[model samples]
Target: MINIPFNKPYLTGKELFYIEDAVKKGKISGNGYYTQLCQKYFESKYGFNKCLLTTSCTDALEMAAILIDIKEGDEVIMPSYTFVSTANAFVLRGAKIVFADSRLDHPGIDEDQLESLITSKTKAIVPVHYAGVACDMDKIMNLANQYGLYVIEDAAQAIDSFYTGKDGIKKALGSIGHLAAFSFHETKNIISGEGGMLAINDRKFAERAEIIWEKGTNRSAFFRGEVDKYGWVDIGSSFLPSEIIAAFLWAQLENLEDIQQVRIAHWENYHQKLQEWTSDNLIQLPVIPSYATNNGHMFYLICKNLKQRTTIIDNLKSEGILSVFHYISLHRSQFYKGKNFNTVLKQTDIFSDCLLRLPMYYELKVEDVIYKITEK
Candidate 1:
């Protein structure tokens, strides 16, 4: 039996070199040379007004919630078929979560039904770009504008993905919304062991975002001599990542193009190989909209039902090939059961039951994954 793990972190060969250089700089703390390099790389590459590296995407989202001033009784609308962090960030700030359903074609939030979910209390809309595929940003952004709501894009899996609006201008995923969050987890396309970033596109939040990232202090401004001294200024936590993680991330950024090409090839291979299964209605493949570009973050199949998915997982385990299911619907979660959500998210529940993520990583051979997945 050939053993294949679900994910393996990739190293770009320069991680250690950059980390050693960071150590030699005599500053391994949060906002050091390497940290600035990683932040600048994203701001320049994605055209974001500002970027700040965080310890995790959760922290980034929390910072977004803070920047937007989510308050008690405020309602935040987002898909139920997302990681808990998406909702938790706002919930922690005392906002009420309005659970939205997933699209029938994809696991992203159902854009068509968003208007019906909004109320006077709706303060923001968080669109999660599942599987690195861009959500319908034009529609989502239009809704936000009409309703006077902030848009915080949950771009954890969408570092390099893009969306082309009706104006025919292509915008990076994180650059479209008022704010966005990204992840560089070990399982992500870009690995830094554990890291994330906050992209602030709306200039209004620029200064405050930096202060929030630096533990609610004006330290960042103080460092640039904009202030005489740094002190506790606002409500915040230690959100910035240390220089070592940023050093590792910079090495990955240096090789991003090469890495993206390989991942795209692997993603295409899976789509082609699984066509027959998908055509037979045995499972459903990922869907990419015309306005959106794929970032090759993940390739997943939707099983017909929970039992079939379970059988498939068991078969893969028997073959020594590891496959896994994704998130559960937050609306139906144990934590949400006692809460006051009246929404019936059928599509979200279906995805929670059926979606399965196959083994995907930078180093894994496409042919090996195809063979294991298609084996009778």
Candidate 2:
């Protein structure tokens, strides 16, 4: 009898209402009323050069890969301790993935080691803002500028997250990178069942992003009366989401601040209460770097080792509480093992085995979760 599950999709009570509105509006397909509303909100709020809602973060990333012209033998750098889509998006375009290790104190890519991974073939750097915690974007951006490479922020888990640079300019995670992808999947801070958006911070990608988003056509311009006829003008796909998804997301977005506050409170509760317990047990709580702002998208702990982590999970399960692990080292994955991706990333491997995510959601019982983890 599992009392606590790993995740529960949250509803804002307006999801179905907006979804129904989308259905009744007779424009439930891509780029309709709800889709424009959601995209405009992201742009206005975050200062994205342009925003295009997609069916999933994966599709947004794929569009990014296309926009950046990732070709065969072109190398893309990213952390190995990331979801496969981070790498797969480029791999599909025939770009070679050069995996980087995670930081010693955080699951984010080790910025210090990023320079070593770059080469003549390196075309782009994809930084995964794991757990909605912003990666050191200033460092990553500086590197990208130095190398004339594109910075595509894989901000799948990062919604309402920010980073403060040394200059004291606080920028939204997706807004800082040249191009960024965001998720509104059920497990994210925001929910739309399955949806994402591409934030084009570079104005250059704006025109083509819509073209690719509309399946290689200038249909968007045509719809705007910018063109007389729309036809296949470039290589692209149907990457945009339906108005139904956009409507559901719009409801969630309208209540984002409330949802964020509740989740952050739970995250703070977990961190504050587990401090002594984690220290005494040789476990490490999640580390929020000073430059990054917590979006409360996740609450995870790093146990001493694989054995300790497994034991904790098993014990939690026996107590009817649920905890889960995260990504494996993409460099060590079976699919890439035969692709000469034999890089040994020590920190990435450790996180793959030891990091454990606790139950976190809008309606989570913070006290119940705290008592179960601490009492055990």
- Report the lDDT tens digits of candidate 2 across residue range 1-376: 7888889998899999999999999988999999999889988988888999999999999999999999999999999999999999999999999999999999999999999999999999999998988888889989999999999999999889999999999999999888999988889989888989999999999999999999999999999999999999999999998999999999999999999999999999999989999999999999889999999999999998999999889988998889999998888889899887569999999999999999999888978877887888
Q: Give the per-residue lDDT digits (tens) of candidate 1, residues 53-139.
A: 999999999999999999999999999999999999999999999989999999999999999999999999999999988889999
Query: In model 1, which runs have C-alpha deviations exceeding 4 angstroms?
Result: none
- RMSD of each predicted structure: 1.1, 0.8
Candidate 1 at 19: error in angstroms? 0.8
TM values, all candidates: 0.98, 0.99
C-alpha lDDT score of every prediction, in listed order? 0.92, 0.92
Q: Residue 289 deviation, candidate 2, in Å?
A: 1.0
Considering only N, C-alpha and C atoms within 3 Å, which residue pairs clash in candidate 2?
Answer: none
Which residue pairs clash in candidate 1?
A: none
Candidate 2 Cα errors over 4 Å, as ranges: none
How many angstroms is residue 171 displaced in model 1 relative to the true structure, after the best TM-score fit? 0.8
lDDT of 1 at 162: 93
